[model samples]
Target: MTAIYSIFGRISETIEKLAAIHRLLPWILAFALLLPLPQILSALFNDYYIYLANKICIFILLSVGLNIVKGFCGQVTVGHVGLYAIGAVSSALISLHFGWSFWLAFPIGILAAGLAGIVVGLPSVRLEGAYLALATLGLGESVRIMIAVTPLFGSSTGLLSIPAPTIGSFTFDSYTNYYYLVLAAAMIGIYLSFSILRSATGRAFMAVREDTVAAAVHGVNVTKYKLLAFVISALYAGAAGGLFAHMPPGYIHHNNFTIIEMVTLLLMIVLGGIGHIWGGIIGAIIVTIIYDQTLEFYFYQPLLFGLTMVLIVIFMPRGIGGMIDRYLATKKFIASQEEKSNAAS
Candidate 1:
C-alpha cells in the first residue's frame, strides 16, 4: 500500500508540474490516454470490461457529486438519488416524447435536476444531524415512489429505447463506442470538482462544514453556500443520470435509483475517505468492481454491503484514501527530519 501511494504521489507531482504549463493540460492528457481504454480492454479481456468501465465512470460522477455536498460541505443528504432520478426521467422523457436529440435533452435534464436540488437543499437551512438525513431520505424515496406509481414516469415498466447519442454518420450504439462519452464526462466532472475544491467557494464550503455558525459569523452566507453545494452536486448527478439513461442498454427504472443504490453510493465515499478529493473516484472503482464480482451471491449482497460499511467505519475509519494521506504526511515528516539531522551533522 505504501509503495502504491508512493507511486500515486509521484504521478500527482508530475501532474502538478504539467499544471505549470497549462491548467487543463493534465486533464487533456488523461482523456487522451484513457481514450484507447476501450480497444485495450477488448484486446486483453472482453467488451464486458468496457461496459464495466462505463458503469464505473457513471458512478464516479455520482459519487463525486455526492461527495461535494456530503464530504466537502458536511451536509447529511440521503436524497441525492432523488435528484439523479429527476435527471434520468426528465432526459428520457424529453428524448422519448419530444423527439429531442441526446445532446439537447442531456443539458435540459441536468437543468431540471439542478432546479430540484434547491428544493432538496431547503431543509438544510434549519435542520441538522439525523433530522436533516431523514428529511433528505424522505425526499429521495418519494421520487422513487412517484416514478413507480405514475405511468407517465414509466411506472413499473421503466423508460425504454432511450436514444443513444449520435453525430453525423456516427452513432454511439455500442459499449465500446459509448465508453468515450461517459469517460469524457467523468474526466470533466473530476476536473471541475478539483476546480471547486481549490476555489474561494470551496473554502467557504469547508468553512460551513467546519462550523455553520462560525461561517455565518464570518460573513460567508452559510445558507447560500449550503444550497450552492447541493445545486452543484445535483448538476453532476444530472450529467451522470443523463449518461446512464443513454448508455447502450438505454433504460432506467425506479429500482435503479432506490435506497439500496443510495446506500451503495454512500459506501463508496465512506470506504474511500469522506473528505478526500479522490475518495469518490477510488471508492466508486473499488465498490463497483467488488459488486460486479459478487453478483452470484445476489441474495446476500445488501447484507454484505452493510457489513462492509460497518467494518470499514469501525476499524478503518479513515479509509484507504485517508491511509494514503497519512502515508504521504509521514513520508514528508521523515524527509524533513532527515534534512534537519544532516544539517546539524
Candidate 2:
C-alpha cells in the first residue's frame, strides 16, 4: 500500500506541476480531448453513442446547477427538473406557436425558469430539511402534472416538431452538428460555474452551507445568497432544457421530466461527491454511461440504482470525488514523509 501510494503521489504531483505551468493548461487539454469525442464515438461505435454523449452534456449542466443550490448553498431543492420542464416547454411553445427562432425562445425559456426559481426559493426562507425537500418535490410534481393535463403544453401527446437551432442556412439538426452546440454550452456553463464558485458569492454559498446562523452573524445575507444560488441553478437547467428541446427530432413530454428524472439527478450528485467541484461532471458522465449500459435490465435498473445509492451512502459518504481527494491527500502525505526522511539522512 505504501509503495502504491508513493507511485500515485508522484504521478499526481507531476500532473499538478504540468497544470501549474499554464493557467488554462488543464482546460485546453480537456477541450482538445473532448472536441474529438463525437468523431471518435461515431467511428468506434455509432451516432447513438454521440446522442448519449449529448445527453451526458445536458445532464452535466443539470447536475452542476443542482450542485450549486444543494451542495454549495445548502438549499434542498427537488424542483430543478420542474425548471427544466418549464424551459423545455416554454422554448418549444415559443418556437412552435409564436414562430420565434430558437435563439429568442431559449433566453425566454431561461428567464421563465429563473422566475420559477424565485418562486421556489421563496419557501426556503421559512423551511428547512424535510419540509424544504417536500415543498420542492411537490412543486416539481405540480409542474409535471400541469404539463400532463394542460392543452397548451400538449397534454399527454407532448410537443413535437420543435424547430432545430439554425444559423443562417446551417441547421444543427444532425447528431454530430448538434453535439458541437451542446458541447460549447456545457463548456461555458462549467467555466461560469468555476468562476462563480471562486468568487465572493461562492464563498457566501459555502458559508451558508456550513452554518446559516454563523454566516448571518458574519454579515452574509443568507436569504439573498440562497435565492441567488437557486436562480443561478435554474438558469443552467433552463439552458439545458432549451437545448434539449431544440435538438434533432425535437420533442418533449411531461413524462420526460418526472420524479424519476429528479432521482437520477440526485444520484449524479451523490456519486460525484455532494460538495466537490467536479462532482456533478463526474457523476453525470458515470451515471449516463451506466444507465446506457444497463438498458437491457430496465426492470431491475431502479433497484440497482437504489441499492447503489444506499451502499454509497453507507460505505462512501463523501462519494467518488471524496475518494479521489483522499487518495491525493495520502499521496501528498507520503511524499512529504519521504522528503523529511531524506533531509534527516
Candidate 3:
C-alpha cells in the first residue's frame, strides 16, 4: 500500500503541475480526445458503438441528477425516471400534436419536469427516508401507468414520428450528428454539476444531508435546499429525456421509463460512489458497457444489478469514487510525511 501510494503521489504531483500551467488544459485535452470517439468507434467497431455512446451520455445525465438528490442532498427519490418520461412525452407531444419545433418543445419539457419535481418534492417536506422513497416510487410508477393508459400520451402505440431537432438548414438526424448533440449537453451538464457542487448552495446541501436539524439550526433552510436539489436533478433528467426523444427515429414508450430503468440509474451511482463528483459519469460508462455486453442475459439483468448494488453497499460503502478519493488522500499524506521527515533531519 505504501509503495502504491508513493507512485500515485508522484503521478498526482505531475498532473497538478500540468493543470497549474493552464486551468482549462485538462478539460481541453479531454474534449479533444472525446470528440473523436464516435468516428473511432464507427471505424473500429460499428455505428452500434456510437449508439451505445449516446446511451451512455444520456444515462450519465440521469445518474448525475440522481446523485444530486440521493447522494448529496440525502433525499431518497425513486421517481426521477417519471420526470424523464414526462420530459420525453411532453416534448414529443408538443412536436407531434401542437406542431411546435423540437427546439421550442425541449425547454418546455425541462420546465414541465421541474414542475413535477415540485410535486414529488412536496411530499418530502412531510416525509423522510422510506416514506419519501415510497412516495417517489409511487409517483414514478403512476407516470408510467398514465402514459400506458392515456390515448393522448400515445397509449400502447407509443409516440412515434417525432421530428429531429433542427437549426436553420441542418437537422440532427444522423447517429453521428445526434451523438454530438447529446455529448455537448452531457458535457455542459457535468460542468454545471461540478459548479453547483462547489458553490455555497452545494455546501448547504451537504450540511442538510449530514444533519437536517443541525442545518436548520444554522439557518440553512433545509426544506428549500431539498426542493432545489429535486428541481435541479429533474432538470437534468428532463434534458436527457428530451434529447432521447428528439434522436433520429424519435419515439418513446411507456416501458422505457419504468422502475427497472430507475433501478439501473441507482446501480450506476452506487457503482461510481454516491457522493463523489465523477461517480455518476464513471458508473454510467461502465454499467452501459457491461449491460450491452451482457444483452444475452437480459432476463437476469435486474437481479444481477440488484445483487451488485447490495455487494457494493455492504463491502464498499463509498463506491469506486470513494476508493479513489481515499487512495489520493493516502498518497498526499505519505508525501507530506516524507517532506516532514526530510525537513526534521
Per-model TM-score, in order, reads 0.97, 0.93, 0.94
lDDT of 1 by residue, 134-231 (tens): 99999999999999999998999999999999988799999998998999999989999999999999999999999998998999999999999999
The per-residue C-alpha lDDT of model 2 at residue 246 equals: 92
Q: Clashing residue pairs in candidate 2, if any? A: none
Which scores greater on lDDT, model 1 or model 3? 1
Identify the runs in model 1 with alpha carbons over 4 angstroms from their true place.
Answer: none
Model 1 lDDT-worst window of ten: 1-10
Q: What is the C-alpha lDDT of each candidate?
A: 0.93, 0.90, 0.89
Measured by TM-score, the strongest candidate is 1
Instruction: For candidate 2, give the lDDT of residue 221.
Output: 99
- The C-alpha RMSD in Å for every predicted model, in order, reads 1.1, 2.4, 2.3
What does the lDDT come to for candidate 3?
Answer: 0.89
Per-residue lDDT, model 1, residue 98, is: 97
Clashing pairs for model 1 are: none
Reference-based lDDT, residue 35, model 2? 89
User: Of the pair 1 and 2, which is ahead by lDDT?
Assistant: 1
Ranking by TM-score: 1, 3, 2
